[model samples]
Target chain A: MLNYLARRLVLALITCAAISVLTFVIIRLPPGDFVDAYIANLASNGSMVSAEQAVAMRHEYGLDRPVVVQYALWMGRVVRGDFGVSMMWRRPVTEVIGDRLWLTMAISVSALFLTWTIALPIGIYSAVRQYSIGDYIATLLGFMGLAIPNFLLALILMYAGFRYLGLSVGGLFSSDYAQEAWSLAKFWDLMKHIPLPACVLALAGTAQLIRIMRANLLDELRKPYVVSARAKGLSELHVVLKYPVRAALNPFASSIAYLFPYLVSGSIIVSLVLGLPTVGPLLLQALVAQDMFLAGTIVLLLGIMTVIGTLISDLLLMWIEPRIRLRGRA
Target chain B: MVEQVMTNPGAIESGGHMLSVRDLAVEFGQDRGSVRALDGISLDLRAGRVLGVVGESGCGKSVTARAILGILDRPGRLVGGRVLLDPGTSAEQNLAALDPNGAALRAVRGGRIGLIFQEPMTALSVHYTVGNQIIEAIRAHKTLSKAAARAATVELLREVGIPRPELRIDAYPFQLSGGLRQRVGIAMALACAPDILIADEPTTALDVTTQAQILALLRRLQRDKGIALMLITHDMGVIAQMADDVAVMYLGRIVEFAPVRRLFAAPRHPYTRALLRSVPDIRAVPRARLATIGGTVPHPGARPTGCAFHPRCQEMIAGRCETTAPSPVPAGLEGASCFHAESVVQEAVV
Candidate 1:
């Protein structure tokens, strides 16, 4: 097991290296850099810089250097815990991302928690009582959840919250608490604001997970081991939960590999519509402004999260299933 | 319905029968209409005796076992029947009448009665170790501590002839060979020490050598424990070797039932006679044609009007066999559901 884990860790490091290289290259793929966007903004305001001044600005920002040299310099600084400065915010990229990253993680984690807790039970119930009225109702609602886009759901929810509850249901904090430092009141306010966006974000994932869990459980319920479990005089609940449900959970475990990356990146449009102060909006701003340091760092972090998620998924699968564990040993 | 005479009157008179399935009928609902899968099937399983139920596929052999255990798959249900399980001390209870999902039936299953499956490969759960599964079965019906259950599981593994019980107990189902897996299945069935064991084609998925070993193990266990064994199979050789009493089924009904020796010695029903003849003789002339029944078993939806086997029987009375179903006739300790059972025997003798 140690050997297997060591091998996986090595593989993960290699994958993260590839992702960093790719993120760096992709961020540079656009025609112009942050300097070009800055110069264009100055010209639109009827204020222009001389060619010599523009060259001085590029040189100061290291944009005048070759791409390879710039990459090496940036990578060396990144290795030493420096993400450079965000050209858009004129601050350190780490400072720009710090609190927003936490808020993003907070919302995503809560959404994921809501998804599994709601989806698993409903999925198991739908499968065990297949074709029943409850099953039919769940199926209908699940399809609706999947069909409606996240941004649309966010819009509908925001309207509903404002109209009926008389509550301002946008962003991660109330206007008064938005700029406050850490406090119980601000944390409570943040908590109050989390559910709306979390629910919006979780709807599609929950619906898809329900469908996947239901289908997998349905297939497993017909297998002979289920009959064997039943024949052991186990109650219907015990039989379904112990045997088929475990077998059905395989897909759920492996899905963790995608869930992490999805939670970070998939919330982009939803974050935009809901006006949640998350890393998603910051990344979008960085990318649009061609702030290579900020955009590349965000992309690289997403990639690293994906690699870690895959590793966790593999370890979880090995824990749950003996077949995979033994195969890993061999 | 014709009044069918019950076979095995001697066992019934002696009050030795542990499980009795009487007038058991099952039906499956399809898109168009319902088809009767088991039609008034009756049999008796006595203590320390192996009752072999032999038939071709779709003859409702497996359905009979499932119905008796109250584990029939969906779209199929017990339309009418009484599965009387006598524990020899208390009043006998009709298992068929018990609510399928109720606690009473749950206690009866794997508690008072156990069932072994056909396919060993799929019968056990791959997620659990063999030891864990057996321990779960043991604890389900008994009030035992975890350590006690684990000890009992190890003992069961040893009882079923698995080598190095301590280590092999931790192995998953996929790690074991087919024979060893079936042994694990047997250990699971015998975990709670049930009064009756219903093996549904237990050896059908095994090779000949493994089949013999499993049969031997089953016989030894049955004898030592005095458990009533209901062995369902399609192999005549298995029936001959393992069964004390034989019940021959055709189209969801038992056509003939007798002691194993008597069934082979003086087979009465034409179906049973054909089944016996179809078994290849080791000393027969080389390069000779093998004997086979004339046609396949008919679909249950399109059952013939009279005797189900008449279409394939040589002695089928033209108008009589085609129009009227024959009630079972008692002959000594055996019985056959055929009008020309005696004639078939006489013709064979001639």
Candidate 2:
């Protein structure tokens, strides 16, 4: 088990390196330059700086160096917690991404909870009472979720909120976030804005989850042990939950490692639709402007998030189920 | 209708019959006319005895076992019958009469009568370790602590003669060999220590040597545990070795039920006689032809009218055998459900 873990850790490091190299290369290949765009923005504003000054500014940001040296320096700074300043926003990339990362985490995590917590039981019930009215209804709902694209769903929800409730799904804190103390009321107001985006994001995911759970449960219901459980005098509920459901959740449970990626990537689509202020928005802006350092940092941060998600999923598997090897105990 | 009281024999005694099944019939559906899975099937499985049910494929051996466990999939059901189990109590309950979702029936399954499925590979969960699956089986019925359940699961793994049970206990079902997996399944079934164990073709999926080992393990467990066993199989040799009482089923009905010795020695049912002759033996006269129960079983959907077996019977009497169904009747200390039970066996000379 130790050997296995060590191998996995080494593989993880290799994966991280591959990701950084890919991100760096991809950012370099994109057309245009942030320095030129900045100089143009300045020129349009009638603040004509000397050519030497513009070159000096570029050098100060180390854009003067070749790609490899710049990457090495950037990697070195990353290792030392000195993520470079944002090219477009002109703020330290870490400070810019930190708060937004936390917000994204909260929203994604909450949305994930809502999806699994509700979908699991519903899917199981649907599978158990399969071909019944309940199943048909769930099936139809699942189809709707699958068919309606995320951006459209978000737009429809946004339009409906205004048309019916006469309310807009925005205004973080409703009095500006600075005045809020992260109090319950402030959080509730914050949550009101989140639903439109979160629901839009979760619709596709929860639909997929329900389908997975239902198909898995349907498969498990046919197992011999399930029959054995029923034969053992256990209640239908107990039989379904204790034996079959636990077993059925195994594949999905293993995939929990990938959920963070699902959350992060899936959030990008919904984030764009909602016009939310998150790392994803900044990421899109950085990419469009070819701000390599800023875009590279976002990609790197996402890589870190992927690692964290995988670790959590692994630990969770060991905790919820003792069958897995944790640091090689068995 | 009479429940268990009228059907079960000698209910008061300790060694009395545990289950008395009578006239149990199962069919697929309406348009797809039901196959007589268990036609007028009557038998007694007493405490502390092994009843090996033997027959060829589609003979309803598995159907009988599934009926007992109440685990039959859809389009298959107990259309008519009674499963009277003693339940180690004075009041023998009619298992058949209970609703599918009844609490009483739930209490009986996996509690009083445990089941061992045919495919051990498919029987245990791939998701959990062997130990966890066994622990789940234990904890499902008993309210043991997680630690206690784990320890008990490991103990059962050891009890089934698995080597390095402590280490291998955490291994998944797929990690074990065929023989070990079967042993694990045995341990799982025996976890509850029920009065009856129904091994539904337990060894059929395994190789011959592994099959022998599994059979021996079951026999040993039966001897030590004093639990009645219903060993379902199509192999006559296995029945010969393991059965105290043997029942021959044909077309979802028990055509003959008797003591293993009596039935094999003086087999009454033509199906049983043909099955016995089909098995190769050194005692057979040289240049003699091997007997075979010629013809396929009738398609379950299009069952022949009257007797379900008449189309295949060699000594088919046009009117009595084909036009009229014969009910179960006594054939010595046993019973054979055939119109010509007496005439067919009277001239029987192997």
Candidate 3:
């Protein structure tokens, strides 16, 4: 078991190395550097600077160095709590994304739990009661959830918020976040604003989970073991819940191996609409502004989160399914 | 003295029979598109002896068991039939027509009729421990407290002859070996003191030695509990060892049904004859080349008209064999369907 974990960790490191290299190369691919962004912003203010001054700024920021040197330097510092400065936010990348990371994790994971809690019972019920009116209705609902894309659902809900509830759509944290420090009152206030966007984000993720879980349960219901369970004179509820449902959960739970990492990607669309300061929007801004240092760090961070999430899930799978652990040890 | 009447079907049981399936036909989907998994099948399983239904793949042996258990899903319809089971004391009920999760059938199934599946572990839940699952099953049928359910489960596991049943009650299905898992399956099935146990290829997935052990265990249990055994398998050897009577099914129809000795020693139907000939008996030392039944079990959509087995029947009797399906002809024990039974017997004995 220890050897297996060691092997997995080595593979994880290789994966992280690949991701870091890709992030470094991809972030630098665009034409302009930080100088161009500064020049363009200052030009709009009618301020002109000499080519020498530009050269001086480039050298100061270490942008004058070769791409590989810059990548190595930034990665080295990043490993020690220093993600380069964000050109747009004019702050450290970690400081900018730190609190937002918590918010995103809360929204996404909670939505995931809600999705499973709802989907499991409904999926099993519909599958066992297949061809009945309830089954038809549940299937119809699943179809509707699938058809109406999550982002579109978010837009519709936001539109409703504007029209009916008169709720503010200014992406969770108010405009004055640059001035205020983190506080309990501010956190609750942030959550209050987080609801619509979080829900919108959850809609797609929850829908995906519901559909997958339903499929899993339906497949399980068809297994020979389920038939035997029913023959054992078990109640319909017990049979579905106990025998079929567990076998069905095998595939679904294994996918949980990637769920948290996918959660980072899942938050991208909703985060864009809400403008809640998360890595998604931060990564986007860094790309557009040609902030290579900041972009590389954020991408690396996200990659790390994804890798870590998958690893933890893999370890959890052993506890969740004793079969895997026993097989491994044996 | 009891075997006198040649024409009349001798009921397998001296006491009241547990399950009597009469003319059961399972057609999946529409008429033209429908699959006849079991066509006009009739049989009886008494309170004790194991009545084995042996056949090749897709011969409707498993379908017959599923129909009794009320587990057949959509696309597999029980078109016509009556699965009459005497619920110990209640009125005889036809399990065929009961809804998949209907109240009355639920009372009969898992309540009166227990089933052991081909793959035992897959049928047991992975999320639940084997002990808790059986306890829940016991609680499902009767009013048993948690402690009582646990006690019943331990005792039931012991009854199935699991080693250190009390210690192993907490073990999950995947933790146990294949043979032990099968024992758990049996224990779960017998929790309700069911009168009939339908074991569909119970030993098909086990090792040969484990298979023998399970067969022995089942026989002993049947004797002790007086529970009927409707064993379904494709292995003719298993049928020969365990079955009191044997039914040979071909393309969803019971082509031959008789006492095991008679069916094996002097087979009647062509399909049955081919099946017996194919099996290499160690008893026959200088064995003739084992007969091979040509062609696979045809899909439900393409089953030939009239006789479903005629396309492959070696004893094709002019137009009658291919054009008009032969029905069961009453012989020594009960049912055996074939046009040239007398001639086949004559050839076999000579």
Number of the top candidate by TM-score?
1
- Candidate 2, superposed: residue stretches over 4 Å from native: A36-60, A171-188, A262-266, A311-330, B1-15, B28-36, B87-90, B126-193, B207-210, B213-217, B220-227, B282-299, B304-342, B345-350
Sorted on lDDT, best first, the list reads 1, 3, 2
* Each candidate's DockQ: 0.79, 0.35, 0.55
A109-130: candidate 2 lDDT, tens digit per residue? 7788888887888899888888
RMSD each, Å: 4.5, 5.1, 5.4
Global lDDT of each candidate: 0.88, 0.77, 0.77
Clashes of 1: 0
Rank the candidate models, highest TM-score first: 1, 3, 2
TM-score result, candidate 3: 0.84
lDDT of model number 3: 0.77
Question: Which candidate has the highest lDDT of all?
Answer: 1
Candidate 3 interface RMSD (Å): 1.8
TM-score of chain A of 2: 0.88
TM-score per prediction, in order, is 0.93, 0.83, 0.84
Question: lDDT tens string, model 3, A1-330?
Answer: 787689779989999988998988877777788798889878999999789999998998899999889888987887787887876677887777777677667767767776777777777777777778997888778788878877778778988998999987857676666348888877777777866776676556565666677777777778766777777666778777766776677676556656765555446666777566666776777777887667777677778777887677678776677777767741
**Least well predicted 10-residue stretch by lDDT in candidate 3 chain A:** A257-266
Q: Clashing residue pairs, candidate 2?
A: A231-B109, A231-B110, A232-B109, A232-B110, A233-B106, A233-B109, B37-B252, B38-B252
Scored against the true structure, residue A142 in model 3 reaches a CA lDDT of 78
